[model samples]
Target chain A: MAGTAMTPYAQLVGPVDVYVAPYGTAEPAIDAAVPSTWYKLGPTTGDQTIEHSGDLEVFRDNDHQAPVKVTRPEEDLMVTFTVVDMTYEKYARIINNVGRIATGTSGSANVKRLGFKRGATPTEYALLLRGSADSPYGLYPGQNYIPRCVQSGNPAPARGKATRAELECEFMTLEDDTQSSDDDKMGWGTVQIN
Target chain B: MPMIDPIAAILKLISDNTNVQAIVGDRVAGKHKFAQAGSVNAWKADQSCIVAKDDPGTTPDIDIGDHVGRVELRCYGATPAAARKIYNSLIELIRDLEGRTTANTSNGTALIYSLVMDASPFTTVDPDLSIDMVVGYARYRIHEYALEEYQ
Candidate 1:
């Protein structure tokens, strides 16, 4: 059955589309959140200056030699991540079996949790917009937003033709609760990466 | 040289410059009152002498309290004014690493800038305000790569 029907390896790359509710597009909200006064120093030639002031501060420069810096006031907030854990899974039956035992019913199911780092700060993120992918939770259509996830690639099409789990994700945000402890300083959010 | 570790660099910076103190330990000592000295006389104990005994070894060592870590900064200069000036210069130097400036310049542009024609009376007398006039500087650093970079 192993004939010489070879195929080229596929590239694993795609834009990360991100979306937010209550807005048609996230770009406007992101732009509006940024302050107009924010700016970074420039280099001599062809130097790009990045400016931002939002719920989070932003800084950037074209050249690596001159790195952009953002200074937060003592009273201002700072966001940083604490690493959690990363896991890999390759079975849907196990997930279905567990679900059936817990819920007392099961038709079929899929489960995957990769790139799930504990306490991973979620302040900074790279979103690939302009895609038709939906969130992993399936809350939205596949034409709108793509949530965060870790990614691996499959080259051969003959490998069962089923989409393999690439990355796991956790969308987190800092909670505004005042009664929470230091470890819970970031609050908590849902994790939905497929 | 490139500091191998950032935290070490920060701690070293604080230690070398600031009069920082660290709390080492806290402990509880047992206290006991002794009475009936020798065969007849009983001992009356006060807060100060509740642990007195025939031999120094018989009683626990007196302890004031536990030590707590603290940091205090002291500046020196030609005069009090000069000390202040120097201190300020050092503070600004640290702030520089934090990408901060008192002049309010960011994003390679002037957030607040003005070309003043008239000199202040204070500056006019000195002609040039040197580190001799600075007292101290305080700064905090924030590190966040702009999302625009990825864009």
Candidate 2:
């Protein structure tokens, strides 16, 4: 998926329907639903600056051959998964970087086998499937979410694609989860970018 | 698994919305292209002629999945509001795209859109919220974009 604007990215064109499982008070987004919220941002005969915030850290791929980033919309009041801590441009660069790595930086998928085997034939990469996302950053104490980039790569062949299924692994969430965090609120209960 | 027809889906959306249907393809009068590919076509028939290419092998360079590339919807109507309405429909269509299937692989772009929808009246003031009325979507597309790969 090199140049193509995939799903989560595709969803960017319109309003997002976010379901925030609140831990305490109702999310500020609930108030955004009011028509008056748009008026405060700016003037509008038809369309004008309503309200927007840039670069909330949505998701990133740590296991990627290159860094990948995803961000919440620029509009502030929009209810979204995860929180708005980072900038959109920075997160966009990360996602673009993932595409760069996947496509060999030519804006295309690296379909040609570059002969970059991940590990030794006899030995296999270890997979850590977290039981749940109840840990420190997780949404709940025992809840879980699936992440695609949590794979292992070998030291050899710094830049190339490998057999993904061969390096498959899994990890579950830890127990004694505490306060309801962004993880649970965002459906990213178990996913960790690191 | 069933294949996704991105172009078809886009056209279906435009056709479904009467407001959009009234403005698309007729550059001289309609004023809205909605979702046009390549060069802008002068006539409605020419504009609506979307060809879905099935041969990924022939074009090994092109990303085959629906969520892999950018999707644009242009509007050239009497008002920006009309264009904005079409933009809203495109957004709705994208949501439908999510409903059709899940992400195919987590390895690709974390699907997202930078929606620049029309703003509502801005005379009233509210301080509780801070975001602009630009209107946008994110994770829903990302999660659904990756779903096609998981199945």
Candidate 3:
């Protein structure tokens, strides 16, 4: 008996939750591990790229026909999302890298001061993205990357328009030798496809 | 056979429990109210309430063909004691139903397997508290045959 062909609807859904661990920490199996703490980012999109190099070789026996050989490449993962809330905690990674934050309290007055300074050392961080709700899928970077804030947009206020800020970030994915299991190193991070 | 909405059945089960109703009263307008997911914003202070939201669940079991899913039930109250009381009552009610296979027939959904509390309820201060309020979350895993598998 022949079975009817049905469209596979196992597509990944949105409203991804982002988790971060200190740089250089070995990534845990994201599918089975719940992040200690995570921030929900949404109305978002994800992008991935693979960098490859190829060489052309011509042999006398091949009669001037060049054979192209391609090598497996590097993977790049990037995500851009808007940050509606401008709280210091929401921008901790960027602030910690590019600025200073002072914390103190006196006489029922709590103070949190954020300021920019030069010569601050750039910090790297490991990132993981999990699908929201009942979707059992996630994406993680194999290794920590020095996050570069490629773009930071100022909040724009307008008549009949909502004011929000945007942050564009890029991470250079690198091979992690710390992972002992080949299964852990499969794909860009340990993504759960089920 | 007609299917039952799991959320509705669970809510009805809670509503029918005398112990839960004694503390939280009737659905939305009671000493303690019950709402689903994002509707907890309407809950008032001094009123104990439980908010249920769907959680990311694990994969289905291959042998029994049952899919286990989690529901995060957040109990909120003006005081820690009140929150704990409501959470305890709900926990006991859930425990009492362990091994029971029959659903509220009125809800028309048969229980495929028992519902179990995944872990002990933990308390925390409400992050969005205007007044001092305590919140506790209990995770429950419900087992049911996946309809997609049948399809």
Candidate 4:
């Protein structure tokens, strides 16, 4: 009998969906139940880094050594995306949470700072990268909280040159201790491979 | 009646080549390792390896009991040049096995009739940069017979 042949399928065919929710709260699914706060990222590019550590042992008689135990130490997801709207309120909110925000009012003669604060208690979000819906092939990072973000760079405007603002955000996956069962600790954030 | 397992004999012959072993190791977890059909997805990016029996064709021969069939050798590589090198190495080894005989415990004996480069090697770049693959196919004919019974 002939061997089973693998059919070609598109693995990266859809736009990515980003969902935001308060920390220690229930996460929303990527389907029709997406929350209003969920925002689709503008064009983005990045990858996830899964770090692992291993212990090796060697014997006096054996010439080769092999790892005895391997463990995953950390997983970091980083992505860079262009800010779609400069005047959007979500931009201000994100900046307020991660950067310093200042507000001041000038009367007839002088102006003074009314309030200023640095972002604290970052919110968690889910990033869903969809493959073909017909097949199980997608990447979902469940309950990823942004640790840090920075503007890419400031470029001077010139003739025939276009400038687009971009932000590079780094995310770390956290275990959902709120879940009642240990099986749901990661909360379905994984690579979908059939 | 005793017969030689053609698949085992072919795999053994390919594994015995030192040059091939140096390029693609004998173990599956090696950087470049030999594989069977439908297992190419497991190979790492830019890895080079050989796959056997991907395509086979059998036909009847009046002179001999049966002309087993044409076995295909698929060579994969990260780059066109790397793939061509592996393909050439396989062709050289197959040519050396011409007119040779090998036996298997399950099967009796088999004679290698000839080796032919059925198709030229060609390169195809995968849109997914992770899986760029180059494939080449070769066909060989073998004659098999059961061991004769002594009265």
Q: Chain B alone, TM-score of each model?
A: 0.23, 0.32, 0.67, 0.64
| Native contact fraction, candidates in order | 0.00, 0.20, 0.00, 0.00
Model 1 lDDT per residue over A85-158, tens place: 11221111111111122222334655443332322222222222222222233212122221221211111212
The true-versus-predicted C-alpha distance at residue A39 of model 3, in Å, is: 6.7
User: After aligning candidate 3 to the native by TM-score, how far in Å is the CA of A102 from where it should be?
Assistant: 0.9
The per-residue C-alpha lDDT of model 4 at residue B90 equals 74
Task: For model 4, name the residue pairs that clash.
Answer: B3-B107, B3-B108, B4-B107, B4-B108
Q: What is the lDDT for B14 in model 3?
A: 72
2 or 4, greater by lDDT: 4
User: lDDT tens string, model 3, A41-124?
Assistant: 232333422232334343343444554453434443344444444555545544343235668886789987666441334455
Worst 10 residues of 3 chain A by lDDT: A1-10
**Candidate DockQ scores, in order:** 0.01, 0.11, 0.03, 0.01
Runs in model 4 with CA error above 4 Å?
A1-4, A29-33, A37-64, A73-82, A96-121, A124-161, A181-184, A190-194, B1-151
TM-scores of the candidates, chain A only: 0.17, 0.15, 0.55, 0.51
Write model 2 residue lDDT over A48-164, tens digit each, in one string.
111223576656466776437665653221111221222322122112211122224345644421223323322211111121221332121221222211122221212246521
Quote each prediction's TM-score: 0.17, 0.24, 0.40, 0.35
Docking class of 1: incorrect
Best by DockQ: 2
